[model samples]
Target: MNDEKIVQRAIEGDDTAFLNLIQLYKIDLYKTGYSFLKNEEDVLEAIQEVTYRAYKNIRNVREASYFKTWLIRIMINYCNDQLKKKNRVVLGEEVLNFQGSADNYFAMEIQEAMLTLDDRSREILTLKYFHDLKIKDIADSMKRPEGTVKTWLNKALKSLREKLEEKGGKVNV
Candidate 1:
């Protein structure tokens, strides 16, 4: 079944449909959690918490088409809260994981640069590049205008470039 139908059924309090929705997006939830937590245990905790939250709030989804984005937002909000509660610092392993073919030095530089980004900028970059989400989807998920998202993406790339340059690393963002 399509995600929209599954989401519709889930919203109607269909347990199986909800489970199916969770199963379909589990990997996405995991990856998003890991990006923030950088710890398997914490990611697992986030996943559990997010699953509960998603199930509890499935009916709140504004549109069936945005179900995936809505689900991801729940994960993101949970992860952000956990990070705030724990006062954790996000690091570079996620960047290395995403850039498999890059050398350690390049990856390290990229990671360091990434660490300096503000939450919004980092989110834009990660959602746009790491997760391969389109600009429109990101805008929808973020509840921002598409032009705003594009502007943020551009600014984020520029910031990333400047940070890399400051470290004497190559600029390819």
Candidate 2:
């Protein structure tokens, strides 16, 4: 179903519809939260709060077609609020011990390198890479101009490449 239909169902107190929407976006939301807080527990809490707030204030959301962006904005705000409440602590390096595949190693390394970036850079990378958002969508989600998003994206990629290169791994654009 279209997001508007789903949201319309949800607005009428359809818990199932709301839950379905949450399920659809939960992983993406959690990963975005994790990118910011780098804590599984904090990510979970933020996701929970985002869902509650979305449900409680569903009436305030003006348009259903914009639900995904609206939800992401809510998640970002919740994560930021949580960060303010408790300053972020650096997370330990992600372990690649689960699978010895080269892809796993590279993913862990990238995650570690991403951790080193400033929050905005990290978020841009996460939105672009992990969430698979288009540059335009990312700009809208971030409330930044398209040109600014492009600039930040280029700078962020360069920063990440340098960091990876220093670790003896190169990021080829």
For model 2, residues 1-173, the per-residue Cα lDDT tens digits are 78789888887888999999999889879878887677787788889889999999877666676677778778877766676676654553356234678887777677778867776787788778877778888887677899999999999999999988998965685
Q: What tens-digit string does per-residue lDDT give for candidate 1 at 9-84?
A: 9999999999998999899989888766777888999899989998888888888988887877777778767767
Where does candidate 1 stray beyond 4 Å? 90-102
Q: Which ten residues in a row have the lowest lDDT in candidate 2?
A: 89-98
What TM-score does candidate 1 get on C-alpha atoms?
A: 0.85
C-alpha lDDT (0 to 100) for residue 123 of candidate 1: 80
Report clashes for each candidate as comma-separated counts. Answer: 0, 0
- How does each model score on lDDT? 0.82, 0.79
Per-residue error for 16 in candidate 1, Å, reads: 0.9
On TM-score, the leading prediction is 1
